[model samples]
Target: MPGGRLSRPDRQRIAALLADGLGYSEIARELGRPTSTISREVARNGGPGDYQADRAHRATEQRARRTKTSQLPTATTVVEPGYGRNPQAAQDFQEQLAALMVQTGMPRMAARVLSCLFTTDAGSLTSADLVERLRVSPASISNAIGYLEGLELIHREPDPGRRREKYVIYDDVWLRTWQVSARQNAMWADTAELGVEVFGAETPAGVRLEEMRQFIGRLSEDMAGGPTEAAINDALTVTAALIHAGRPRSTAELATALDWPDERVTRALRDADYTPDLIDPIALRRTESGAYAIDVRPERLSDVQRAALRDS
Candidate 1:
């Protein structure tokens, strides 16, 4: 039921309606637009809580220039009005997209440029193409492209036919985004686990920190696609210590103690780099015979344990 693109006046009306506490469906009905369109628009522009008519209108204008850039009448070609019926609808869509990206923590100009690349059917754009389409200064385009490249969201490539550089979107872009998230989750889990130890395991703060550790740890594992080499190394360190406690541990025991999957421990043990010195022999004793599958060299046998390692 969406008609021509929303004008600046239309955005102002939407904002006024939003301030009056109307829902998206009610607003859409008032504006004569499909509910979905209104929903998306509101959601992208800071949702119902923060929608601003002027900001949304400006972002819409920015989007319009980018899409309509292709039709900007080259020497051999004439500009064609093919973006949308109202020319303003295309802009509204672009502003919404850019706003959504910004909501996910991308810089505004960078998000706008990325939105342009994402919406284009060809999946590529050049410096000239962007500058022409967005009607912005070349410096703005350059800075946005640089920001996007730094974040691994886009790449610069040679346009062999034109001898100019172009930005290209990777087909597996979301995979790269997930990888970054996985790394952040891993960091968060590690920091939270450390907090649990510092705050005392019995304290409420420690208990809350442990919950955070568990949540982010699981997210790290799930987003990783598989067990990473670093994860394997850390697991090996824990397994080694448990085995050196003078008893053989079942796969289930290791999994339960470390809060990891049984299969992961098994895999880490098979490929664990035992060369790394994790435990100090001066402060700890070797495991009793037959405790470990691998022949860990028994050294500096002692009954005394460090305060840090002692239980109870």
Candidate 2:
């Protein structure tokens, strides 16, 4: 889909497509490419939203200049055609894509496994499929998938009428990924605020960390309650509606609705602190399969339950 030495015309078209908001799959289909090719190209270049033909071209030139400076003889020996119609070409593409993925923050083997999936026809790939396709050991594929799943870049979906599960990448992958980063930043920012009190900002280390705290704190405030709780709540309520319309609710959903903040959400969940979860009773409902589902199932607390909450 995305690899090969794209012609100047092709680069222009790709940039146009990106600017028009075409998804990777749509662009790939139009170009008669595997989506992985497109994904790797965009990721390695500058990513979809930030991609510019001239900028990517200049970056590529800069990288080439660096490669020349290294002047390693093996560089010429290893440089292969961008797109391959043969097994060797496919392997070469995978390896190159793997290296590029590492630059994008993924580990080497995880990148290899992920790139291999892009070359396949089925959107979903099983553990066994990965092992066979990439010619890696079962254990290696398992481990790579585990890490990728942990990053929330991939998800495990149950096989219909089958026992096995397949890893899937959805259209909303990057959107959700960005949300994860934002939540993490918010948590660390909150921790930094706490640090200011424990370690006075007058000291060097404390001051440096406190500065980071202020920076993150400002970002958090802009995102959530800093400037306006009304805006944050409005945005969150819409997201909640979207979730409730589709998937089942878990502890995560309860925390988000209660506005517990990300840190308190994780801490309260781990410590069995019911404060966050108790905000929305309907959020705690269980479906027939014993899985939690979101609905308008409010609980009427008795005199004793009310007293317990009051005491806590």
Candidate 3:
């Protein structure tokens, strides 16, 4: 029973336990189910305060019937090649991920759409494909796509020689999302600072606002416009190659050593120079021969230490 679907009686018992002031874990223990299962069930069914056993049971039944009917033998209901995956397991995983996303403040339809795209092998889907696979209205898919695009989590691209556009999740989706978050943080910090000015500096509200501004300002400063993971990795690789060479190397030589193009090597070298903190103590410098070399800066030492080294 713990691994099976919740029955109508189970819903009744859960409602009773909730009315008795029992927590999710307590109800789960009583029902021999996982706490997450109990929590998710209650959350989706009008929560504990308004949960009704009969209504929740009916809703679950309707959803199941709709899903079953939509998945009947039809052209759109055919399963894709699984490449050895169990269809039921994949479906369960997708549902679980969508539930988690919903818990994190995403709308239910939007979360479902995002999860469906993520689970697809090609990482892109047209509106028609989404509608067919999700068994939802085209308008629902359109709204979800707009929401995801606003958050920079997905983007639209024109389908090759087709009237329909596809929603694509690129490899750098999270990077763009992080940048959007950083911009939002900066805006919050600015607004908080303005609030501090609106209220008197010595007032209680001003103190709170000032503190918020300082905290978010520091976060924005750290997050805004930072080097991407790809750039950082390239810089480190180039630095290691130069260090191992034990001498200044031309861009062409470095490119050949790393099996990269000369332009790519140049870009890596430039990023290393700009973000020296990624490779502290060791610095990149250009020699008179127009080659790059690793140089250790002695400026990190105290004046007395530098004088002592010079005397030695």
The top-ranked prediction according to TM-score is 1
The local lDDT score (0 to 100) that residue 127 gets in candidate 2 is: 85
Runs off by more than 4 Å, candidate 3: 1-4, 12-24, 36-84, 225-312
Provide the global lDDT of candidate 3 against the true structure. 0.80
Write the residue-wise lDDT of candidate 2 on 1-312 in tens digits.
Answer: 356666666667788998988998988887877877677667655456556777667755765685576577665434323224454446556656666667667766787777776655555778887786656798888899888788777888997887899888655655655666667777897677466556665667667776786577556544532323444344345335435558654445655666657554444332221122333443333343322445533355777887898899
- Off by more than 4 A, model 2: 1-93, 160-163, 218-312
lDDT of 3 by residue, 1-312 (tens): 469889999999999999999999999999999999998787666566667899889867876886688678873654564312455446556666777777666788898788888888888889999897777899999999999998889988999989989999867866776787788887897688568667855679978986787677657647866568998899999999989999999999999989998888976776676567788888887654557899876577888987898899
Error of 3 at 109 (Å): 1.8
The TM-score-based order of candidates, best leading, equals 1, 3, 2
Per-residue error for 195 in candidate 1, Å, reads 2.3
